[model samples]
Target chain A: MRSKVWVGMVLLMVALLMISGCAKKAVRTDGDVSQAGQDAAALEAEKARRAAEIEAARLAAERDAKRLAEEARLREARNQFMNEHIYFEFDSAALTPTAVSVLKEKGAWLDKERAVNVLIEGHCDERGTNEYNLALGERRAQSAKAFLVDMGISPSRLSTVSYGEERPLDPGQNEAAWAKNRRAQFVVE
Target chain B: MNFSDNFLGGRVRRWRRGFLVLGSLLALAVAVCPSASAADYGYIDLTNPYLRKIPLAIPDFKSVSGDPATVELAREGARLASQTLDFTGYFSIINPGAFLVDPKTMGVTETDVDFKAWTGIGSELLITGLASLSGGVVDLELRLFDTVKQERLLGKRYTARQADLPRLIRRFCSEVLMLLTGNPGPFESQIVFVSGGNGQKEIYTCDFDGGNPQAFTRHGNISLAPSWSTDGLWISYTSYQRGRPDLYIRHRLENRGAVVAEKGINLNGQWVPGRFELAATLSFSGDEEIYLLSGGGKIIKRLTQQPDIDVSPTFSPDGGRMAFVSKRSGSPQIYVMDMGSGHTERLTFEGPYNTQPSWSPKGGRIAYTAMEKNRIDIRMIEIETRRIVQLTQGSGDNESPSWSPDGSLIAFSSTREGPSRIYVMTSFGTDQRRLLSLPGAQSQPDWSPNGIQ
Candidate 1:
């Protein structure tokens, strides 16, 4: 996001510089030998300068709009990567098709952002023993990491941890809360 | 002390546990309990499936000095004695109010007598004691008698600094337990458990009777799965103090420690019996597997190579074998591995979710938690016969079953009464009761040998 904003600012500055250069060109044209001819030339330069400033302003606005749109898209993707947890069924670490698709989308984003690394945290519901759930949580994390690695993300870039039942996305005791809790989550590094 | 020695005559009895000698005092108990000593195997057979709960009476302890200080000390001693014995679940403590004779006037000797009154109250056994306090020191003389046989079973006189009154009562209880069950009761033991609601849990320990509950770790981080080192000087637990589930091996007293902050999860540390070595689950290899670690948290060897998760390894009392939870069999189930040969066998067949296997200190049995239809209960498995016995009825989730040092009882965390709390029951699934009550929730009780030096 920072890089995109930097690019947008750089483009805006370039457009401002172009508009100022067009005005300078118009000023240089004003000192011609014939007054009438020079006035016409100045008039022509002003028309061109006005057109250039208008075009520059339009270009800057377009660039800013594109940058904002791209940023919103990136924000959504990152939010999806972090917030859209790959859920697992109770007492299981196996990935369903839905989980696989989520991992694949995350994989694509990871592919684009080469330098980014992540920690995959596995969590469990409040059932079962805490100690065993810890292992189950780890397995869920590993399965998610493996899916990402299989999708071409470097294994070195993906680390894993198990929170067992200590953490819950939903603290309620019902199935809905439990379904939200039995998941593998991501933290970007 | 001399009279105690004469009554407690005999040599030490050695067992596989190496026995808790407790200096010459415990050594002096053998010559005592003439009626009980004749049956050296112990008056109570703990492993007997049909073992009946002994109906024991603990009347008020007499104050020799009869002053307020001595009187208070005597009353406190009797209360502590009765509470600790009742915790073992081997004794059904008869209410003191039922005694026909006032405990204030009862004598410690068999002749001070009212044996008929005790028998009439259906008390199979009786514990009578007296306390004398002088100059910040207390001397307690306690005796256990068989009401039906009209015989003095065990007697001991313990002297200690006044503040050590609890220790005096605990020691006497140990003596009574030795005569009755052969093994000293869990009175000398401390239970380490995770205490805190939700986040930032810490390791807390209390006496066997839920006395002196204090924080063992002040990490102010999420710490889980604490187990005691064999000698009780060190504690091994997994702490995320550094933002990872790393194994921490710290001394129970002084600020000394070791760490195995491996690449991935380093968790569920279990100390080998009578050794500084421990077994823990590590995922540094990108898969969670059990590995042996030195006391200082250095890796020794990998114990499991299953394709799936293998964790929560509990070693047998002899350290010859380990039973752990593994998903190699498709679901979480208990699996026993021969530590010597590295041969592993699945232990439970009926439950799809059976975990937290605790190897009893005695032998052959492993107690574990089983979950069905979202409810969890504690169950035990016999090694040779593959016998499965449920130790807890399903109520709220009963999880993380841990065995006491004596193996006569099992401790675990239960959510039966709303918020979770630590609880214990007889090994045969009787006398279920909450072990302690604290402000916050507590779970994962690991009963260790005496933790204080």
Candidate 2:
């Protein structure tokens, strides 16, 4: 009866040792699973931050390109306005009907752009004396200015200068070149 | 006096027929003897259309001093004098290679000149010079001889620094011209013009013969309509240097300038004949008008009240009248106004366009540009007789005529050679020749008054 009791105590000790070893193995496995889950969450957060940074960079580049294109468009529009010249008859400062129509368009533009100041450069054909041509050019510019003012553009926003026969648009001495030369040009200030 | 007395007596005898005959004789006499009676010196018939250029001989000058520099200068002086006289178009220089008399043996005195030798070479006039150099100064004695008359016409001596040889030679030549013609030569004068080709117009000046071209203004901008002050110490022009069309006066010698008038469109500024005042076209009143301003550009008087353009006011030599261009008649025409009485009258009526009126220094005629047949040419009008003379025709747009101070020649700009160039011609529009062959086109030439210094 004493030997039977000693064998029962050894069996109880073996069972208790097996239960403790199983419980330790289960805790180590759970710790490793939680650590791996925390590492995956950190990597996912890093990847989302990189994607957000790339998207922000792409948006900035698009904004810059749009701004540049808008600037070029504005420059082209301004150039069109500046390039519109009013031509005159040879040795005469009197504005033609065509010149009046062109000036009307310029006046409308000027009226809308009140903040922009302009300079009217009066030019003449290379036919007369420089002094008299200067006077004629001034008269041409004044005529254009008057037309614009009559169309409701402010006089203070405009100034006139005469280049006389000194500056020719076309260097040819023919009538076609002269017709192109006798003009009133615009400059934005 | 003997010739005039005989002529007048003969005219009085011929005039006894009637008052009309007397009038005609008087007119003829006056016309024939106007310049001859004014001076005792022999005169050339400049008005004769068939008049020949006077044959003049200038041999190599004699070196009075033993210095080598003096010998070199003597040779240069003779050459310069010949060149200056030749440019006048009134004298033809005889070749030195054809000279019969040795100039070294001949002296600068009438007694020392062999008049027979000079007359033998078809020379009507002779010039002899003797030069001596000492201490960086040259003493030159010049004598002009009427070889045909075997008399000394003029004798003068000048002493100056080495660098002043050109001036000395010019002054002596001017004296020679004064003795022959009633007016001095334009050799000492300068021409102020606008030259452009480098994308900017700049004011430039050259000698009367188009030598020694120098930039008068280096503003690197558009500078135009240069006019010399009466004293020739200043030049007034319109420049865009200050970013606007303003009138600026520059000192020709000091290399300094100032904006004289910045009013609305200060276009053309010309000095009054004897005063420091300027007559310019200013649009300060909202319309272009001629105005008289002080040398500093202070407005002294408003010369015109026209609603149209009144520009390019040129003062009469006496300053009692002003001639300018006006558009009050529907086209540009020249108008003259009396300063004292304020009486204005239109001076041009023949052409549809008449502008750039430069009143003659002699005070009776006005030179201007007239447009016809889509081409422009130069024309002049007489104030008294209302006679209009066309000076140029079919010459490819000749304009901007400025008379030489003596009124013997007119310097203008023309595009006859494909590019605008400055040209000079006689008052009658003879001998039209290019003034300068510069790199770029040049225009608006104003000849300075003679004897600037």
Candidate 3:
């Protein structure tokens, strides 16, 4: 009877040991699955941060290019107004309708830019006395300035000078040369 | 010697002639009955200053020998000599038809020449010349005799080409004038200026009396205010070719030119002795300043470093002094500068604006433009004498008076018409005439020497 009771106790201890070992193995597998999920979450966060940085860099480059293009366009427009020279008639200080039209265009440009100063240079052909031609040239320049003043430009932004017969556009003593000489020109400062 | 009341270019011819004839008869009656009183001083004063025009007789010229060309040249010489003395307004030419001694009978070299016949024909001065052409060259021998003194005043012989007969004549005439009045003749000289109206402003040159107008420059740029060198071979002018103003030297002999003031604004350059220094209005400093530059384009000196407008500088005949127009006085006025001392003196005080001063070659007179009311006229100021002579009386805006080398005429630009034209007049401002008819305008007349030859 004593030998039979000892075998029973040993069998019971082995069964308990097997049950504990199975539970421990199941817990280890669950830990492994949790570690794999945490690694996937870390990789996804890194990919999202890199994508956002690239989008911001591309937007900045596009904005810089657009600003450069805008600056170039302004420069070209300013040059167009300054490059042209205005012409006038022989012995006539009166501005023609065509000259007025041109001035209007110039006024529009000035209004848009608002930083340029216009210089009205009064010039005459080499026909008249120097003193008289000087006076005539002044009159022509004043006339042009008056036109500009009437066009809503500030009078303070304009200046006039008369070269008289001392300056001629054409050195030839012919009708063609005189016609070219009788004029007032515009310069921007 | 109140001869007649009739003159050319006058009005009321018949009425004035009758009135003057009646008045002259009454004055003669009164003169016979007048006592030597203060009221009679007027008649006596007029009689005391009895200056009469001296009579001269010019023959067709006596040719003793030489080829046809030689004879032709001799006659031309005599004709030119006669014309020169006659234009002085001092001598009168006796009619050739009134000659008592025929040239065919009496020789020009006669020692016992009959002075009685010439005197009776109202001749006080006599000119004779003989010309010979050989090897395509002309040898001209001329003689001038004061008939009253019966002494030869001049006996000059010259050699030139056959084509130079006219010029030779003019020179001989000028010599006679020099002997009579210590002043040289301006006939052989030229006038340079600018003309406009037809459609262009071109520099034109002509004789002192507005004859032989010729155009010299044809740059598309504006050309004006041509000043001549003492030799008249080179012209200093302002040109606007590089879009900026610059001075240019044009050599008529070489037919070549270059910009002397290349980098700065240069206007109205006149020549000085031994150097090409000019008084130019420069903008190198961003404002118009007067600078003195060497002929080689070196900035030798700066006359005015201020910012006011200064232009139109004329050097005195001696080149020791200069007269220029300056606006430092708040308006344009004539100013004089002494070169040695670098001192300046204001010369003009009359007009609201007096500019474009041209110093006479005699160094005595300053010709400038003075404002008259609203018009401008040419005026003269005698430096030593302080004598003011108002030259022009026209309504045209006259400016830029360029005196002849001989100081007998002035060429200026006027705006009497719609455009400016070049005009020549006596220094006294009596005779006026236009030189160009091109529909385009012309201005700035500068006289050259006998350079075309």
Candidate 4:
């Protein structure tokens, strides 16, 4: 802190000397003028070096912030892939038009991010028996996978599982909840 | 609550706290009118199923050595025997308050029970138990006496450790049921089921009548569809422990097992009766198809060729035929395929959705779940006659019908009281009662024959 203050003071003093030298050229001695000129040159070099260092630190900080933001954005993208589900009708695994659109987006995302692998989980409403629901859930998951493969995602990168009615997205025993529970969910592996 | 405590017509006074505690289990104490054939002592009419529950009397058990510990055992033994017998949906227990004589003055033998005292109280049969404890071992003798004829129908003696009293009593109950029903009842059996919800499900097993329920798998992940091997040694189930559905065949007692973690879903692993192999739904072939897998989970052969979903394979008692659910005909229906010829035929035509076919051990009927007006119920289809009998009705969906080892009872799961729980009823759907209550819902019950080693 003291050195920076000293440097500022020196620069101010040199500026005053130059201003005075310009105004009173006849009163200044030759040796005094030469010393001031030498000091000015060295001060110019120090100022340039400090400006360069400040610019480098600013660029470095900006790059680091950009990298962190990109990482967070990728994490959010993965989360969106896991949460967007393809829903089905009662006791049926046939994909709806809305479900197909959602799978289309999923396929595009998977295609853009080639390094991703996912496990598609098939689920069911609490209406059917667990054994049948398990099989139905698997069928639903396979339905989603088939559509994604049709949209150009590698079948190898996509796996499937069936939670049956074991894990319900909504525990409510109503129509709305049952509709929500009968879905195909994605889990990034 | 003393005289008419049991709808079966008999109850003992002060059998202990456990009696009153378990006495509430008289939920199944059905009002079977007294049988008219009480004169035919030692004879059971198999043709007349669901006959009146035999009016029975069980006196307080006595200790031979008069040891305090043995006396406690005797009391518990009597209560347990009576409770187990009551669970058979037989023996309307007669009240001991109406007994003409005290049990302490009589020996636990056919000759000691006074015929006039019991016959006068409407007791058709009676059970007398005696216990003796020595060096941490208990000697128990239980006898079933025909009070009408004043003759003993069955008698057995067993010596076991203190903790094994339930097993000993079950052995005696099996004897009693053997003599009465021809086939021993489910007293010697156990039920494996799925319990727990809210994103976690695990496998559980309990003795018949819902005693000693404990978690069979600690996977802490979603485990569904537990199938007990007919040999009573292995339990096959599907667990999500490895993050994907895999079929796990684990020994009931040992610490070793095999897993089929094939590429896609490995749904339900059902063991072939009396064989070292199992059938499971594997999707590695790009579609859900049933395949025969070795007991160690090695794929032996693909059993089904279909573009539609075909899963849940159940073999007949003789392994000559396999029954399963398929969507080959545009809707979910059950189909049976002869194992020898691989010829498949649709066994159900009444459904837009019919699945979960459980082949009865008796080999003539296959019990399955059917949907009627959006409500699920258990229905049995006789193979030869194509007679479908609706076994469950008017309760919150009752599905997953598993036949007891004797085929006289069907154990299933229902949501009649809200959360799904295990329940049992006669094959005729009479005397419906909750089997057990656990934290979280229970489903997918599979009964094993002779739960004891």
Tens-place lDDT digits, model 4, residues B135-220 = 88877777777777676666667778878887788777876776665557888889999999777889999987887898999988
A-chain TM-score of every model: 0.79, 0.67, 0.60, 0.76
lDDT, candidate 3, B133-244, per-residue tens: 7776766666665667565555566677766667766766766655554445676777777654432355666665565677777776566668777777777777555444
Residue-wise C-alpha lDDT for candidate 1, range B1-453, written one tens digit per residue: 212222432222222122233222332332222222222211222343224557899988899876998898888888888888888766678987788888887667866878998999999889888788887878777777778877777767677888777776777787777766567868888899999875889999988867789998888889989999878888889888998888888888889999888887888668899888999999888778999999988889999998888889889888999988888878888888999899988888976788888898878778888887777888777777666666667568898888888777888989899889999887666677888888778989999875242
Clashes of each: 5, 0, 35, 8
Instruction: Between candidates 3 and 4, name the one with more favorable TM-score.
Output: 4
What docking grade does candidate 1 earn?
acceptable
- How far is A39's C-alpha from truth in model 1 (Å)? 7.1
Model 3 RMSD, rounded to 1 decimal: 15.8
Index of the highest-DockQ prediction: 1
Error in Å for residue A139 of model 3: 13
Q: What is candidate 2's lDDT per residue for B71-113, written digit by digit as tens?
A: 8899999999998888777777999999998887776676778
| Candidate 3 total steric clashes | 35
> What are the candidates' individual DockQ scores?
0.49, 0.41, 0.05, 0.43
The C-alpha TM-scores of every prediction are 0.85, 0.80, 0.64, 0.80
Instruction: Give candidate 2 regions above 4 Å deviation.
Output: A1-77, B1-50, B65-69, B255-263
**Tens digit of lDDT per residue, candidate 3, span A1-189?**
887788877777777777777788788779879987887888888777777777777777777777777777776666666655456765456788887887787778778767789777777875534543554565577777788889898988887666775667677777788777787777787
lDDT of 4 by residue, A37-117 (tens): 999988998898888888888888888788878887877777788888889999889999999888988888899999989
